[model samples]
Target chain A: MPGPDLLSSQGLRLDGRRPNELRRIRCKLGVFAQPDGSAYLEQGNTKVLAAVYGPHQASKSKSLQDGVVVNCQYSMATFSTGERKNHPRGDRKSQEMSMHLRQALTAAIKTELYPRSQIDIYVEVLQADGGAYCASVNAATLALIDAGIPLRAYACACSASMAWRNGQPEPLLDVGHVEEAAGGVVLTVASLPSTGSIGLIEMSHRLHMDYFDVVLSRAMQGCKDIEVILDRAVREHLAEGWTKQDVVVI
Target chain B: MFQVRKLANLTLFVTTTPTKRYNKINKSDCFENSILPVHFSVYFIFHRTKDYNSCKNMTRHVKIRLASERVNHSVSSNNELPRFYTPGEVITGMQDFMRGHGTYAEDDSLKASVAGVMQKVNKLICIRPLKSRYVGEIGDVVVGRVLEVQQRRWKVETNSRLDSVLQLSSVNLPGGELRRRSEEDELMMRKHLQEGDLISAEVQSVFSDGSLSLHTRSLKYGKLSQGILIKVFPSLIKRRKNHFHNLPCGISVIIGNNGYIWISPQEKSNLVEGDKDEIANVETQTVSRSERETMGRVKNCIAALVASKMMLDDTSIMFAYEESLKYEEVKDLLDTEAMLDVAFLTQHKINYVDED
Candidate 1:
């Protein structure tokens, strides 16, 4: 359990963010010329670059008859953290992060449209602040959109922490590194806000049953807010990359 | 003349000193005036700092810019912009219209599945993405690299979602056009069109799974040798009746519908019927230095057009090639400002033709 230092006297988190304010997000799509689709996203201090290749023919071992295989790899840079790490990927944490990423991304991609194909998504974390998973999910969604892959809706992920203000439980939106290290219960939710569906929900540490509802709802709200930002970014990219063929048809 | 002298002095300073401190100062100075000449000197400085041993009279300049400094080369037309759509955005009620390519029907509403402008023909509504893998239609021309030589078919990568198939029977053998395929031909598959060889073919049929079957029955479509291939977004390739162009500037170009452009020197002699042995020696002939230079200029011109996301066709490419002659050196056109200038001039010529 964390002390009352989780929230200041004015009901702000340790990073001076209000209970419901998300961190600033800056994103760009199609950053790389080689990949089918690529995106770079920054959420507060966490920067993630995602590249998506294929919907092309899948290998024999991974081919599916009814739908496309979603392959996800999550790797962090050796110097991304406070201390220099030796292994960048293939450890226990990266494998689990890769699985979680596939789950959230697969739920949004329209797999049935591409039969016997595969989409490979590679996410490289340059800087890992708190909510790295959330930023990874958001960046992968943008990459999928850039690839022109069909999607049911935008898959957005956001993290929230439970803080107490004057003996009242307040759910903090968009947890930061300081709040995460302070040992508060963090709830991470990846959801399709437009479809009103939850792709994945993960909770770290323990939270009371009554507090779970508020924390989950706050994370869901943050996803909805992120969907708006992502939608705008996609529009801006479309405007810049559109050619004469797209406009002359109308 | 003044710019030439400035360029000469800059290169002299770079090649003579070749120190880290001088290189650092030279890089910033060249970046400020990033025209054609400065681009060459900057390339020289980069070569000196990285590979001191191999620093000969290298004149090639490769421009590297930060992501924040990237220039948006998209040319916005004066016409009214189309209404764009994003994924999951509702296009219309499903009651009156049928969903097409990039749209999906859900909950009595037609929503777009890709981000782009919407197109409607009668009651069908489709949203086309600005960029995607090539979707082959019947009779579409494509250039593909041979990936695998299967039993009687060769797997081709045509920038499509699935690998295209080129059956052994579809290709016209060097001996004759109407020869039947025998087991000998199956054994000689790798010798004819092995892995990593590029060929121009036409889409014969589309499979139910969306893969394309290509054919190289025509004499014009066959093995491409001694050429430069430039790939751009498939959407930028404007469909035309003739994808092959023998430009007046002594070169031939094959603009594959799959967005692969092959710029090669014009063939001196047309292949006569039943000239089987002559086909073997085509790859061995040496291309002249002048022809190679022209091909390089054409390739750089195509790159410039691709940078601006312009529609690629024979006319636009020829216009760009003509506009690029002012730069003198082929490498000069690689500079961003020079590229933009060529693209702008070509666009102006294209618009002029359209108005006339």
Candidate 2:
């Protein structure tokens, strides 16, 4: 009974959020002028920056005849986490995260159209608040959109956690660092929300089969909510730069 | 043939209706500001822990603004903003229209796959994003840097997604026109254009995979020396019959379609017909202090226009130059206030011309 309390007696989560409440997502596209596309995204206390370059001619070693190659790199700054880290990138954990990011983003990108081309996506986590991977994925999606790359739909990612209240199991949306360190089961999901299909699913702790559906559904729903926010940002960005003369009528 | 909407004309001509326009502006401002949440202090769950510094770091200096606050404010377009589509938004049914770039067909609907304004030409629909990598078209004048000197070609980076090719066959061989390229000429490729050297060329052809083939066969197109290069988004450059201009203010500007612009002191009439040797000698010739000042002013003026998202062409550029004369020194044009003033005055001049 001495464990950290994930939920209070009144049913609000530890962070005073409801079971279905998400972290506040604030994002901006075209944050950098040098990259083909760049975006900065902040989710709660976590902040991420993503940049995308190319769809250009690929090198001989990496070129593919049938589809485009997606290259991803995930690096966390030394100051991003509670402990200072030595390496910013090319570590074992960063390598795995890079592969995972490529897998999720490639599913949403229309890669077949750009044969013999490569798209490089680099994500830098400037701050970590437990859902850094999810924030990185979301930031990469925005950067790709800013680059004007063709995509099947908006790719979104979210993390969910499970807790018990009065012996009834409930799922929490958008888990932060505090709950993540409490030895709770954290389920992360990346999906194309518009298409209603999940691209990647990762779970940190084992959970009972009976409660799996609840947690997965919560994560998917978080993705859908994130899709709405990201879509609004893209539309607003377009409206800001759009002019009446760009469209031709014939 | 897209017709400019009458509302755009009205916005320019109907300046007399200040009350209604003022109300509309205020209403739009309210709508934009209301969408974003008010800024609050950062939330830290582990306040009782040993590290209070981390909590302070979370709230550190984040400049959050609503999307509307990032708009280009140096100049406002008279044209009404267009309807925008995001990825997966169904633009139209797939039955009648052919899908183009930045669009895809899914579930019997033609959806936009990029965020931009939609354009319909005949039976084809395309989305033109506001900013993207340079997509080359034939006959486009582009400024590029030599990236690598390969067998019979020099790979040039023209701000396009791909490295463009400048073949030896396509170049003027630095001596004369109608000269056949030889093995000796191939060996001398690097001597003519080495790595990191800038050159202005014409886009001769586009490859099937979207790479451009550039040619520097004309007298106007060749190795550029002693000029400041400025790059802007390709979409901001307006396509016109002439991309090169010799401004009356004693500076020459080459507005490349790839968004790499070159500004240099205008060559005197005597220097125009210089050969390779004479051209090399001209490089050593000292450019007068006045000419250098004029060149810097032209470069800064173009930067001001680019910052405002104004259409970049010779006329608008010249207008910006004329408006920038109020600034006594060339370096002063780069300041925020002067940059905005020059852009605003140039936009006014452009609108005045449109009215006439």
lDDT (0 to 1) per candidate: 0.87, 0.85
I-RMSD for candidate 1: 1.8
True contacts kept of each: 0.67, 0.69
TM-score of chain B of each: 0.83, 0.79
Can you give the lDDT of residue A99 in candidate 2?
A: 92
Candidate 2's displacement at residue B84, Å, is 0.5
**Cα lDDT tens digits for candidate 2, B1-356:** 11111221111212222223223333344355353222432211123235546544543332233344343544676887777888889998789899988999989999988888888889989988888889999999999999999999999999887789999899987566877888999888889999999999999999998889999889899998887899988888888899999989888999999999999888768865655677778667788889888888888999888777688999989999999989999988866668888988998898999999
| Candidate 2 lDDT by residue in tens digits, A63-155 | 998899999999999999999999999999999999999999999999998788889999999999989999999999999999988888999
The segments of candidate 1 whose C-alpha lies over 4 angstroms from its true place after superposition are A246-250, B1-68, B270-277
TM-score of chain A of each: 0.97, 0.97
Q: How close is candidate 2 to the true structure, as a TM-score?
A: 0.86
Highest DockQ: give the candidate number. Answer: 1
Residue A195, candidate 2: Cα error in Å is 0.4
Q: Which one is best on TM-score?
A: 1
Q: Taking the tens digit of each residue's C-alpha lDDT, what string does model 1 give over B1-356?
A: 01112433223423333433332444345445564443333233433244545544543443455445566677655556578898889999889887888989889999998888888888889888888888999999999999999988999999998899999989998676778899998999988998999999999999999999999998889889889998887888999999999998899999999988899999776767456577666787788999999999999999999999889998999999999999999999988889988998999998889899
